[model samples]
Target: MPRVQDVPSIPPAGRADDGGALPPVLDVQDLKTFFPTDAGTVRAVNGVSFAVREGETLAIVGESGSGKSVTGLTIMRLLGRAGAQIAGGEIWLTRGDGNRVDLARLADADMERLRGSEIAMIFQDPMSSLNPVFPVGEQIAEPLRLHKGLSRRAARAAAVELLALVGLSDPARQVDAFPHQLSGGMRQRIMIAIALACEPRLLIADEPTTALDVTVQAQIIALLRALQARRRMAMIFVTHDLHLVGDVADRVAVMYASQVVEEGPVADVLATPAHPYTRALLACVPRQQRGEKRRRMTPIPGTMPSALAVPSGCRFHPRCAHAAARCIEAVPALEAIAPDRRARCVRWREIGP
Candidate 1:
């Protein structure tokens, strides 16, 4: 296990196209996470790879059970308690000091030390993530106390500031309020405050606005954008909504049955998808054109395949409308479809726009 300090820095060769000369803050390469169930080993995240540069947001979009959240949790190393394991691949994380470390190989102790200060995660459910009995301020302050070694009083004061930063009204009074006292949106804001308290270099927000109303959801999205802009931190936003992707994410990776079927700039992918799964997902989102009535969403024909028994060849072939005999013969590699885009469909040239 390499110590955080001893990890060597990554060479500044592959700079991001949009983020100037900065290297990716988090580069996940071929990550595979598995869970051993009573029936079989569930490959929750299989061969997933993507990168997020500082101040950039990468959205993992897919339907329920498509491994979007699993990939995020895998990156955060939060699946151990649930009997999941990193089966293979590298999770190269660039640290604040310019050193890069493969988090997959890091010792649990070293990883723990890096969790709050270098990387943080906001779970889907704030109510379940927060300690019910503890005051929201204390919960936010806990990371500051542990990571920064701040005095208790100072940590509390900083927590109040974070609440305000996240746009929570009456931060001073809200700090003393318990989780149960807050509304769903407020609790989500508290969760965001806690995640951002340590000023982590990379933040993984897993469906941050899932439970909020439309207005509050919009508010949360705006708040996240503002916070990320101010802090210049890399973020991975996991969600099933393509609508939210356009607003929050710079790049989008579409996952299906534990694999990334398509990946590219959010605008490019949304406008003209390259993979069948990506197109299917877009079709499910209701849309309206100029001088035209709103089009009804066309639901995908089949459900996501079970991770424990994923289909051979293309995992998405079962649900893909463009799947041909060749698609079922062998698994297609994630081939580059364009300069900055990739798709895992063999017939992408023939079927893609």
Candidate 2:
């Protein structure tokens, strides 16, 4: 495994290296997303930062409304014009062939080209993501035909192949079926097939296995891991399940109130989370082993603060049991607590997972 120090630091925007080559695969520095509403400007993602390396799985875990989906949408440049806005920061993208592009600044036409071809997303609701009028095959084939310039016949055949690759049975028969015809798990498989159709270097899966049976969830997860391994693709797995993150994530970024509160190797963060929020989340996961008869899960106290009225300093401080006076007065920088591990808590060193 490569050490954290070995991963090169991505230079700031407009400050590319003299020999200026390509940008990082996905370099996100201090990204922020705001939504202007009747009441106030909702900061959905505030100064959140991370990177997704080629052929790695970075999992973002947070409670609902913690800006997980917003971050993913921002990276894909899919945020709509009506309410959302990228207030600051840069999203740099590097293609497989070494071409560097700034995703945040790319024109609409260029961004369209990159969406399905260079990058793809697997949305949470397979039922809603698929179009009712279009046959499953056509939905999968659309990207292939659009990006790869494949003939109609070739695209159709490729779609069948993708279906089989994602573990669907009877690819030919399933191809002609509509989204409503397939089971939840099967529809998710189809979504994976479409996302993988273009051989995108980056795949953002937003809670891909949710709303499925346990057996089906396991299968979908296994399929994702296999596809990621076979394609050597960089994947962003967004889910609230720490157990799932333990199984798949190479690295983990814990988000709270539109901010990356902590990030580091999956094992390190899971075993000994430095941030109070991280520790509280870990404690909430149910364990069935031979420990003392467990009380009910120790869910974090208090509900998530509303997006429009996020607390100052550390967003997690209000719910954090270990919060101190400093936590209320000043915000914390994402300083290194360990090699490649960082936390946005002034007293990270004192807390234990």
Candidate 3:
């Protein structure tokens, strides 16, 4: 495997280099998103921070309820309907024109204008995200019409081209088809087409491969890589599967109980995880060596703690095998464990390789 380049601690605002030395397209600092429920305030995402440079893919992976999805939604400003609020933090996005703006502080009108033009998101379920009443072509053309001010006829023509761009066959005919008329993979392709219509600088793909079979999932992954490379766009790939992260992401951030426990290059983190939660996650992935007996996968011992009442000290202490007494006394800061790696565990040096 090739050595992964180190991501700068503070990314500058500009274009990317072929050697992965460019500044971050999106830099999230101490993001805290909360939802006030009837029972209590749900801290869906707490003090989560990461960055993705132009043409780079950052995968946020964890079990369900770990706040990976919420973090992505928060970045897209799509959690307003869910009654979620940004209690604190900054979401800095560098525009295509090299202007940096704090998305958290951007006005609603400004954010709305930036959504499809500067940043786009591909949701998990196409059926729910796509309008059944409208043709797929019109759905793809909506962003072009609204953001690019394209005429109806030209937008429709571009939609067909987008469908074809995403590997859909006979896009001219399929463009007129309703959401229900297509297969799951095809619908997903249509969603990708709509997202890429405006050629946004950044894309937030929230579990875009859900409900997809292995074959179709591979195809979608390849298509996304091709498109991202061609457009030189940054992407946040959110998923629960760590196995998928190795295939797609340049860097991986492991989240647990609304916080990031570990983050580093995909190769280094997977080979030598610096956090207990990250180790437990890798253990759960089933793997077998050639000419050897298959080992039984060891499931992570406990469920993730409730966000409303997260455990003190180390949030992952309850499920960590090597947890110690000090883990319950006070919370551990996400500190540097290696040259380019960070882990939220006080005993990382004692416990890690």
What shift in Å separates residue 236 of candidate 2 from its native position after superposition? 0.6
Per-residue lDDT of candidate 2, residues 1-353 (tens digit): 11112222344546433245433467788899899999999999999878887778999999899999899999998899657988998877777666566677777777788888889999889999999999999999999988889999999999999999998889999999999988999999999999999999899999988788889999998889998999888999999888789888999999998999999999888888899888888788765668768757888899999998888888888998888999989888999887689999998777654
Per-candidate RMSD vs. true structure? 2.5, 5.3, 5.8
Model 1 scores a C-alpha lDDT of 0.89
Q: Worst lDDT window (10 residues) for model 1?
A: 1-10
**TM-scores, all models, native as reference:** 0.94, 0.92, 0.93
Shift of residue 143 alpha carbon in model 3, Å: 0.5
Task: Sum up the clashes in candidate 1.
Answer: 0
Those runs of model 3 whose alpha carbons end farther than 4 Å from true positions after fitting are 1-21
Q: After superposition, how far is residue 191 of candidate 3 from its true place, in Å?
A: 0.4
Which residue pairs show backbone clashes in model 2? none
Error of 2 at 335 (Å): 1.0
lDDT of each candidate versus the true structure: 0.89, 0.86, 0.89
> lDDT tens digits, residues 81-104, model 1?
879999998898988877888888
TM-score of 1: 0.94
2 versus 3: better TM-score goes to: 3
- Cand. 2 TM to true fold: 0.92
